[model samples]
Target: MKVSVQGVRGSIPTSGSQTTQFGGNTSCVTLMEDGRMIILDGGSGLQKVTLPDPEVKRVDILLTHFHLDHIQGLGFFSPLFDPDKEIHIWGPSSITHNLHSRLNRFLSPPLFPVLMRDLPCEIVLHDVSNSSFEIGPFTITSQFVIHPGATVGFRIKGKSAVFAYVPDHEPALGPKGLIFDKKWISGFELMEEADLLLHDGQFTTEQYGKKIGWGHSSMEDAIQLAEYVGVKRLLLTHHDPAHSDTKLNEILDALKSKHTGQLDFDLAREGMEIELG
Candidate 1:
């Protein structure tokens, strides 16, 4: 399996010399091989990614949520303009509305001149639950997480390995944190021994103390979760925009020193690539 980090930043994008190395796009990742492509999110990073497979005429975008940062790139995705491409979007439906209405709430009207109907591609939307689904060689499963609305995490089991995306989460994974029903948090068990787990590590230990219900995780929290879940590799992503490259490096170094063994990790940078057998 081949995974590429098209964008890694969180909240808003960043720039300037201090932020150059880590990149500034929100959240987009792609898995590609031969004649197929699977996109994880459409954050600003998605706008910059050129699909690895030129022969990919069919695309499936597995969205974790519909937060602006997560869906912003959908409007600019070049393939949406291609009338011949078959694009299917799968995501959690809000309690008040289905997937299409929820997306159109942001994607249409005065907010944007073009509507989903205006798009030339054969677009389809699937509102998903905590169930397993399939797209080509990938068996996709989703779970609910503690966020404001219907936030979810995804696990994609490909032929060679399992890759899970936890772009936003607020579980208390440490000793002092409050315990919630295991079933309420969908992606934990699905991530067990995962080949690669790209999870939300958007706050520092200190910052997490004050932002408990904000629906993001600290590096320490993530490390503990990764260790407990037996993940082989953890890529800490969904970086906070205010964190400069230097600050992120400091956090990365600290995390590496504090956690070691079967579970390994690195900060996810835009354009980084990993291969799983």
Candidate 2:
């Protein structure tokens, strides 16, 4: 399987000398297994890729949520409106409506010039409820993450490799006076032993403290979870908009020093590609 990081920025896109190294595009990734394509998220980074014509083959898109930073590129994903291809979209249903309706609103006219009904390609929406299922030659498992809206972490297993993605999440917050819930711990367990674990590392410890309930985790929490889960390689993702490239590098260095010879890890960079056997 081949995994490509089309975009890795978090919260919003950025530009300037500060963001050059880490990049400023929002979250989006493409995974190719054999000849099939699977897209994760449709952040601003989707603008980086050329969408195939509807007459071409269809692809699968799995979304974590409908947050603006996460789904901002849906309208620009040209294939969605093409009549030739089929788009299979899977996502957790929101509290008020099913996954299909939520996505429909985004593609409807007014907000979007094109309505989903006019799209040439067939769009199939699936509301994911079970934790596991199989799609094509891959086995996929998911878990709910700590986020304001409904969000999910995905574990995809191909013939010989496994990839886990949890782009927006908060670390398990221990009991603090009256607040105590351990659900976040189970979310991390879903990524255990993954060949590649792409996690949310949107803040430093200090920043995270001020942003509690914002549904983001600190780099420290990400490192600890990677170590605990025995992931072969951890890719820090969902970078804070305020974090400059140099600052991000410094954080990487700090983490390397602590992990030493224990684990292989790196920051997720836009256009970075990984091939797993």
Candidate 3:
């Protein structure tokens, strides 16, 4: 399996010298396994994704949540303008609305020039209520997470590896704050020795103190989860827009100082491509 970090920013986009190293575009990732292309989220970075082969016509996009930063790129996705393309979108449906209705509300009318119904390509929206499903060569299992709106974390299993993605997640905040003893995450099974875990480490310990319950996790929370699961590699993502490249480096430095040689982790950066076995 091959994974690429297309964007790493959280909430809003950023720019200037402070963001050049990591990137400014919001949540989006491209995953490839056995000649199949799968997109995780449709943030502004989705616009940067290109078809390596023009002959490949079908694409699958798995959305973790429908926040503006997550879905902002759908309107500008180039394939949507191609009549011959086939796009399938999957996400959790809110208690009040279905997936199609929620997406159409933003992708239509005064907000955007082209209505979703008028798109040239055939777009399918699947509302995920059950826990597991299959898409081509991958088997996906999702579960609701701790977020304000309906949100889910996904565990994607290819032929040889498993990848877990949690773009906007809050660590266990319930009264029982035990790490390993409690199943705080929705898709907990995905954490078991995952080849790569792309998780939300959007805030630092100090920032997290003030922003508790904001539907985001701190670096400490990410580290704890990775340590508990014993994942081969942990890649922290969903960077806060306010955190400059230097600040991010400081965070990395702090982690290095604490764990010594015990753990392997890294910060996910834009345009970073990696292969997983």
| Best TM-score among the predictions, by candidate number | 3
Q: What lDDT score belongs to each candidate, Candidate 1 first? A: 0.83, 0.81, 0.86
Q: What's the TM-score of every candidate structure? A: 0.93, 0.90, 0.96
For candidate 2, write residues 194-216 as lDDT tens digits. Answer: 99999998988888888877888
RMSD of 1: 2.1
Best by lDDT, which number?
Answer: 3
Superposed Cα deviation of residue 108, candidate 3 (Å): 1.6
Q: What TM-score does candidate 2 get on C-alpha atoms?
A: 0.90
Which 10 consecutive positions of candidate 2 have the poorest summed lDDT? Answer: 175-184
- Estimate candidate 1's alpha-carbon lDDT, on a 0 to 1 scale: 0.83
- The window of 10 residues in a row where model 3 has the poorest summed lDDT is 177-186
Range of the 10 consecutive residues with the lowest summed lDDT in candidate 1: 178-187
- Those runs of model 3 whose alpha carbons end farther than 4 Å from true positions after fitting are 175-178, 182-185
Pairwise TM-score winner, candidates 2 and 3: 3
Count of clashing residue pairs in every prediction = 0, 5, 0
Candidate 3 per-residue lDDT over residues 1-277, each given as its tens digit: 8899998999988878999999999999998887888999999999889876777889899998889899999898899899999999998977798899889887988878888999999998888854799988899988887777899888889999899998888865665542575455544676678899999999987898788889888888887887787788889999999999999999989977887445689999999998987
Model 2, CA-based lDDT: 0.81
Cα shift from native, residue 172, model 3 (Å): 2.6
Ranking by lDDT: 3, 1, 2
How many angstroms is residue 90 displaced in model 2 relative to the true structure, after the best TM-score fit? 0.8
